[model samples]
Target: MSLPNDASEDRMQMMTKTERFSKLFDELERCREDEQMQKMEEMNGLIDEMNEEELKSIFTIELFDKIHQIIEEKTLPLENALVLLKHVGYYRELKIIYLESFDYSLLRERMKEMIIDENEKKEEINEKILTDLCECYALLGEDDIFGEVLSIIVPCLLKVALKKDETEEAQKEVEMALLALGNIGYWVEKESYGNEIKEIIKYHQEHQNLTRLAYQSAWEFLIKRFHNYESLEEVFVNDLHFAREARREIEELKRDVDWKRKEETGKEAKELLIFRKWIYNIDNYFTSCKLWNEEVEKLLSSFVQMIREFRDNSKKVSNWCFFSITNAAENRNVKIDDLLKSGAVDAFSEEMKQSTLEDKIVYDCLYFFLNVSRRLNEKKDDEKKEAKRKSIKRKMFEWIEEGYEDVMTSFHAILPDLAEKSKFLQLSKYSSDYLWSL
Candidate 1:
């Protein structure tokens, strides 16, 4: 069913990127009853080859307008038009994401015309075409003219999401729209638009229609707007959905039995890492806010559990948790004592023996200790806090006394293996300062 690697390469070698892209659409346009699905798959595969020259070269405004004229003048299928635009959206480069309101209007109108109105004005909305358009706009976030397109596209996406209970088709459309909104969420700068997104995220999540990835994407989208306004931060303080999303996802991962077996290899591994990324992001969002509330406190506690539970799972999981603590610590509000109280030091110490920690972890751990020593130094003259500092230092010493120095030694011993001198120097200073401070 799949093209062999060498054959795929040979096919590629015969055509330049633009040539291949142009030809794919030409084939898609004339493709018949027996070959549609295969042709679609081939078009989807072109996502990898998508770039500025190939896209701009193939779809000049004149060419695009001509296609529009043809679609209107003939009873032509509009699927290839949306498919081409979807590929254009997939080209992630922002400068190339040039949008024209006329182009947007044309696409929307053509999709409407695909199945025309009749008596009772009976209209059949093509969910599949709508799906492609939702995705295209979602991926086309923050383009030069995206602000203009937002008023046009955002409402359409929201209308789909609002119809969540109407039909199975609407529910599927809701899920698709939520994800599409998520793709463009962070780029949302308008408060009205951001609030609309925030409420939609809440509604779908409460209805149990939201996935963890979609939920994460919604917040990531909102943070751009949320960060600039105090009123927005109150969204977190007043609501529990954000924390519930984190807790629900973490609990699911822990309960995922198929993901736990040591010998397993599949999507579980990739998905676990994705879960970790989502957690890390929300974890940072909690810390970034100046306002503290129940959601923040609860999620921080959840993060602690995330580190302690998954530390021994796998190197990837271990490093993932390591990154969580390291990143969370960037915010001073994520107090060091809380991490220690949750056994972060003991958790990391377990990872030090016979464990292969990554270089980035080594970097963060070094600065982490530097920050710790500085905190200790801040309280050095306070006799009242002496016992507290010592008690904390003792836990840290266990990580080093157990196997940390050896880990550091191995890293420094092969310093030349480092590709960049700045990184080498930074690591060198981090190591030297951390050891000296300890």
Candidate 2:
């Protein structure tokens, strides 16, 4: 009654795909420790080869429940388990199961244990674990759980962020912690943790010890959580107002015709130095948000004045002014006419003539010109559609014509050297290509 070889082969081919997958799963479960990794790899390969319908049919709720059980028992490393979930395209389902099955408490307890153990060892925290834990809590969005997690995670993050004489690895840890804090900031109850988080970030923002990258992360966190104009306005403008008052006093003193008084005023003007740093940090936020209404108009006007007046005294402030204006113009939210009338064109043109200016400053100036020129070209393209458009284009064209020669002369003088520098090569290439096209 034994089957022939051909008949046996036919019977093996007749086995359904799901039956084969089930055999693989059983083999994986029974595999020895040394073979488990190989089995998982094969499973992943088979899963990839299966079509969506086949996958759906094979990966049933029962199988998922088994996977969850394995995860809870720590049969596999957490990262490896998460990766498997990702490859299987079941991360969302897994998230839902975890949220609904009261598994967050388990995750929370694990995180707390890990933090305590690391602290006891006086070791750098495991950033990857904390990041994953935070991401899970963020997705769950349960306020109480989020608050508890935040309370634990924030202290650990601050410890890293505030570490003295940190190693390179510790610096990286600080970055990861800040990024995680930012991601977690999106889910926490603003009333309870918002001000607390802001205070921590503000400390970093004003702290002299932290790197620029740290300050940037702090600002990004604020922008992510509180995106409104008023919130940002309070952070940037309140301090800026004091700086502006001091600037005005310095300006008035410049016209005093008293050499002694002017020198005294120059010393006081140096106080505005800190404001320049704050302005540099917040300018991109202002430009990206397009907070160009009447209130910010004063700020923009002040920038134009700063470029004209402080160009010789503080190139840093001047460079930032050009950057803010360039960003605003690039977004096309600020009117080109307003920028032209504000003497931004003249200021930048003058800066371009300075042989000793930083390549970055010159790059910003050229970028501003490139943006304006591109905008002008767009307006010109629209001139054919309407008479009113033609009139506006004509005015803009005339305004640019007045400055066109000087701008191009500056561009030509700098293009050769700029095209050679490694740091500015890409931008210079872009500028060269755009100028040639025109």
User: Best candidate per lDDT, number?
Assistant: 1
lDDT of 2: 0.53
RMSD of each: 7.9, 19.0
Q: Provide TM-scores for the models.
A: 0.65, 0.42
- Residue 140 Cα positional deviation in candidate 2, in Å, after optimal superposition: 28
Q: Candidate 2: TM-score?
A: 0.42
Encode model 1's per-residue lDDT on 161-194: one tens digit a residue.
6564646665555655655665565455656676
Q: Give the Å shift of residue 348 in candidate 1.
A: 2.6
State in Å the error of residue 410, model 1.
6.0
Q: What is the lDDT of residue 164 in candidate 2?
A: 46
> lDDT of all predictions, in order shown?
0.56, 0.53
lDDT of 2 by residue, 272-356 (tens): 4234434543465545554345445555666778787657765555677778777766767676666666666657666666657
